[model samples]
Target: MLVDNHCHLDFPDFAAELDAIVARARAAGVSRMVTISTYVRRFATYRAIAERYHGVFCTVGTHPHQAAEEPDVTAEELVELSRHPRCIAIGEAGLDYHYDRSPRDMQQAVFRTHIAAARATGLPLVIHARAADDDMIAILREEMEKGTFGAVLHCFSSGPELARAGLDLGLYVSFSGILTFKRSEDLRAIAADVPLDRLLVETDAPYLAPVPHRGQRNEPAYVAHTAAVLAEVKGVSPAAIARVTTENFERLFAKAVAAEAEAGAA
Candidate 1:
């Protein structure tokens, strides 16, 4: 089965037909999805979505863009919220200098909080690095020295340098619909170089739809297209990519997988 390692089912865009969207994903072989949290204040919305769908999981953290708005976020707060059985990861948090949506220092501060939470809880952090790759890499490197944390560079669009930094630091790299773009040859090259165990695929739904669906809203169901392209780039069948990446997902998010395994065993 396929899995959209990351998505935002809690967003307003899918509110009207959330059920149908999830159903479509199941039909497309997407067995599970992680509905990402962008704002800590509305984490309940994400929790509700995860509760309603067995195949859906969720993360708890603030996005970089919302840093200023969530200035009081603390590592302890994220760790506390992550106690929920449905919360499998610590963040969609990191640097995003591309938009300057929040002050750079604020973004860095919030990102550090997320790193701390991930380290404390032993959960994988869902990272989002944008144009400020150098700063992002620098912070990640410094943080690694302080204490290592499990993390994945979600929807990676940064240059080779950043990808190398992430890989060297022992963070997994996830590809999105962006890999299907014709001009993403360089991205594909980078994808090719990522170790098999460290590779992942995501749709980043309601955004960055693949080539055939470019400029349109994306969904977890479309992760297959991205996976197909990734398989092509890696010179393997789509099914191989599916199996390996799904295994990688389970390995990285150990607590979630262990819970699911126990349930099945029972």
Candidate 2:
């Protein structure tokens, strides 16, 4: 079985056919998925999605674009909300200079709050870093110095410097459907360097759908396409890539694995 380690099923894009979307993912061997929280105000919506499905999970925190609107959100708030059994990680949050929707300093401040929540709750932080690589690297390094916390660079599209630094900091790196694009050879080169134990795969749907489904609204089912490309990039069989990433997902999101085990035992 495979895990689409990051997704956003709570988004309106999938609202019309949520059941069918998840059903197709199951048919594609996506046994579980984590619907990322782009806005903490909608954690309830994410929680409901997790509760409605057997294999869905969620994270809690704000996206960088919405950081300014919810500037005062604290680690305590994220920790308390994460008490919900469905919550497994913190923050699809990080710097996103590509859009600059929020002020750079505000994004940095808010990112730290989510990082604090991750450290406080002992949950992995689902990060999204874009064109702000230098700041992203600096913040990650500074934060690690303050105190270490688990994180994954979701939908990775950064350069080799960030990837190497993240690996050195013991952070996991996740690939999205973009890995299957025709001109992502540089990204594939970086993927090849990431240790299998620290590797994970996601779709970042309903966006960045892999080739063949490019320009289409993506779903968890398409993670297989990215995984297949990742396998080719790493010189392994698709099953091996699936096995390693599934293991890495469980290792990082231990709470999700625990919840799944409890449900299985029930």
Candidate 3:
């Protein structure tokens, strides 16, 4: 089964039809999904959704855009919140120069905090980077020097240099519906080169829906479209793509896998 490794089921857009959305995702062969956290304060919301759905999981962190709002949120706080049985990762946090909603310095500080949380908790960090490639590369390199940590460049849409930096540092790269756009040939080329073991697929739902479903509100079910396109780009069968990405998801989000195992045993 395929896994939509990253999504936002807690978003208001899916509020009324949350159950239907999960059902549709399962119907589409999406056996697991992680409803990402954009604000640590909303950890409960994300956790509740994860608790409600059998195959859903959650993360704990603040998005860069909301960095300024929770500037005081500490790595300790993130680490503590992540102890929830369903919370599997840390931070959709990083630089977002495109929006500049939070001061660049504040964003970097918050990102570092999340990185620290990842390092301490041994949970993968879900990074959100945009138009801040240089800083992202620099920060990742500098942070790696400080200590190694697990992370994924989620919804990646940056330059080859940033992608290369992440890969070189042993970070997984996740592609969203953006990978299926006609104008994303460059992105497809990048995806083609990413090692299968380190590749992941996501919907980034309520946002970048793939072609044929473009302009529609996205959900976990639509991850199959992105996976199909990725298979074409990687010269593999769709089933192979599903197998590789699901394996990658379990590797990167091991806590989710362990949690499932424990639930089954019980």
Candidate 4:
């Protein structure tokens, strides 16, 4: 089975067919899906979706793009909200210089707040980085020095240096559908170098659909295609990619794994 470690099921694009989307994902062999949060304010919506779906989980945080809108959100607030049974991670948060939708300083502040929440809660942070590799690396290194936290570079399309820095800091590297793009040979090279245990796959759904589905609305189901390409890049079979990524997902999102076990026992 495969696990889509990052997606936005709360987005309106899937509203009319959310149940069908989850069903399709399961049919496509996606056993789990982490529906990421982009706004801490709308966390209840994310939690509701996670509760509505059996294999779905959620996170809590403000995205870099929305940093200015919720600049005052604190680590304590995130930690409190993340106590939900299905809220398995801390963020889809980090720097996004590409859009500059939010002030850089505000973004950095909110990002650090999420990191603190992750550190306190022992939840893996779902990081979203773009066009800010140097700052991202510096902040990550500085934060690691302050204290260790579990995290993954979600939907990674960054340079090798940032990848190396994240791996060096013991963070997992999660690839999205961008890996299947024809122009992504450089990304494939990075994926190839990521140790099997440190690699993950995501869809970032409602966006970045893989080949054969590119330009279409992405869903957790298409994570398999990204895994297929990653398998080819790693010179392993698709099944191996599935097993390894699922294991990596469980390890990184250990809260979700424990929740599943608890539910099974119940």
**Highest lDDT: which candidate?**
3
Report the C-alpha displacement of residue 76, candidate 4, in angstroms. Answer: 0.4
Question: Which residue pairs overlap in candidate 2's backbone?
Answer: none
Best-first order by lDDT? 3, 2, 4, 1
Runs off by more than 4 Å, candidate 3: none
Which regions of candidate 4 fall more than 4 Å away from where they truly are? Answer: none
Clashing residue pairs in candidate 1 are none
lDDT per residue, candidate 3, 1-266, as tens digits? 99998999999999999999999999999999999999999998999999999999999999999999999999999999999999999989999999899999999999999999999999999999999999999999999999999999999999999999999999999999999999999999999889999999999998999988999999999999999999999999999999999999999999999999999999
Q: Between prediction 1 and prediction 2, which has the larger TM-score?
A: 2
- TM-scores, in order shown? 0.98, 0.99, 0.99, 0.99
Listing every candidate in turn, what is its Cα RMSD in Å to the true structure after a full C-alpha superposition?
A: 1.0, 0.7, 0.5, 0.6
Residue 263's lDDT in candidate 3:
99
Where in model 2 is the C-alpha error above 4 Å?
Answer: none
Could you tell me which 10 consecutive residues in candidate 2 have the lowest summed lDDT? 257-266
**Model 4 — which ten-residue stretch has the worst lDDT?**
248-257
Q: What is the C-alpha lDDT of each candidate?
A: 0.92, 0.95, 0.96, 0.94
Error of 4 at 159 (Å): 0.2
Error of 4 at 238 (Å): 0.4
